[model samples]
Target: MIYVITIAIYLIGLVIIGFFKAKQIKTQSDFSVAGRALTPWVLVGTMLATWMGTGSILGNAGKTYQTGMAGLWLPLGSVLGIIILTQIAGKVRSYNKFTVPEIIGERYGQVARLLSVIALVLAYMVIVSYQYNAGGAVLHTIFTDDSGVSAISVETGTIIAAVFIILYTMLAGLLSVVYTDVANGIIILISFMIAIPIFLVEAGGFDGMQIAFSEMGKPEHMRFFGVYSFIDIINFCLPGFLLIMGDANMYQRFFC
Candidate 1:
């Protein structure tokens, strides 16, 4: 019931935001770049929030649970991406391109633009699908019961979530998405800060945590390096590194 109430509150908040934003919609540029009036803080907040979506939270948690501190490498890779982005921030803003394809076309050619569009569309679709799956898993865990709506099948729940995303995104476009991301980032950070300590205390402090970890047969899980080799870390970080070098989303945020 608490979980349902929480979700309801979030949905209501999103609806209210979308409702007001609808009135301000006018053009494609307005939809795509939010009129290019976003402040730096807003840009940073949205960038952090969008990057730290379902994949970052759930996927990272699962990775950390199984592979220990090696999971931190993912966030580390993201941080590197941000740092590299900073170097090109001025260039991106100067170019003032809305989409990746536009930037690629300007720099390279028509072929580059077309190829970029194809790759971006395919990658984004896959990303959205994964996020839908993650949300469904959360809902299923929260609302499970022997009966009553059958606790919502993962596929059904995912479809519903995806529909909401589509509607909200389609309504106000980047303006709505960026502002919501900023707000969500704040909420997520606060939630983690509060939850982690409470959870640690309940689990009985550092000493108790050690004992439990030993029982689970993974005492060194908290170490920074853990058991991963240098080669393993490089392999894990490579995709993120390459993506960051030429990510359209990062460039958009830079320009915005």
Candidate 2:
């Protein structure tokens, strides 16, 4: 009940913010770049929320729970990609394009732009599907019956999430998204800060975790490489590294 109420309030807040921002968005530039007047902190907040999605909170965390430190390889790719992006970030922003394909169209051709659009559409579909799945899982968990059966079906929850996202996006474009992301980034950071110490304490600290893993006959979980091979690490890293390098969302943020 608490979870449902909290989520409901959050959703309501987002709607209100979207409507408020919509009034300010009178032009294409205002919608796309928030009038090019966002603060550095706002950009930082949006970037953080943009990068850390369900893939980080749910997928990577689940991997770490099951296979331990090996999961670090997944994010390492993104971290390295970000490091490289910093070098060209200034140039990207200076280009003053609304989208990645727009920039590609200028330098390359209509053919490259079309190809990029197709590729990005396919990639974003996959990304959005997982986000919907994660949102559904959260709703299902929170809306369970006394017997532990979910009151809300995953499909219903997924549709709800999809509607909310679509409505939010259509409301005010990047203006609302950046503000919402700033709030989300702060919440996520605070959540981690509060949860980590409690998690360590509940698990009886690092030594206790080591002992527990040892007793479970999976002491390798504590090792730097966990149970992953060199090939496994490379496989885990490459996709994220490559994705972040060409991520249209990141480029859009830069354009903003």
Which candidate tops lDDT? 2
Off by over 4 Å in 2: none
TM-score (all chains, Cα) for each model? 0.92, 0.97
Q: Model 2 scores what on Cα lDDT?
A: 0.87
For 1-256, candidate 1 gives per-residue lDDT tens digits of 7889998788767766776787788977778888888988888888888788886788778888887656788666667887887887888788877887898898899998899899999987887789888877777777887555557788887887777777778889888888888889999889999999998899797778778888998888766675788888887787777766766677777767
Report how far off residue 15 is in candidate 1 (Å). Answer: 2.6
The CA-based lDDT of model 1 is what?
0.80
Candidate 2's residue-wise lDDT over 1-256, tens digit each? 8888999998888888899999999889888877777888999999999988898888889989888656667798899999999898889989887888898999999999999899999999998898988888888888998899998999999888888877877899999999999988999999999999998998889898899889999888787664788888889889889989999878778887
Segments of candidate 1 deviating more than 4 angstroms: 146-150
> In model 1, which residue pairs have backbone atoms overlapping below 3 Å?
none
Cα deviation of 63, candidate 2, in Å: 0.7
Local distance difference test, per candidate?
Answer: 0.80, 0.87
CA-only RMSD, every prediction: 2.1, 1.1
Query: In model 2, what is the error at residue 1, expressed in angstroms?
Result: 1.5
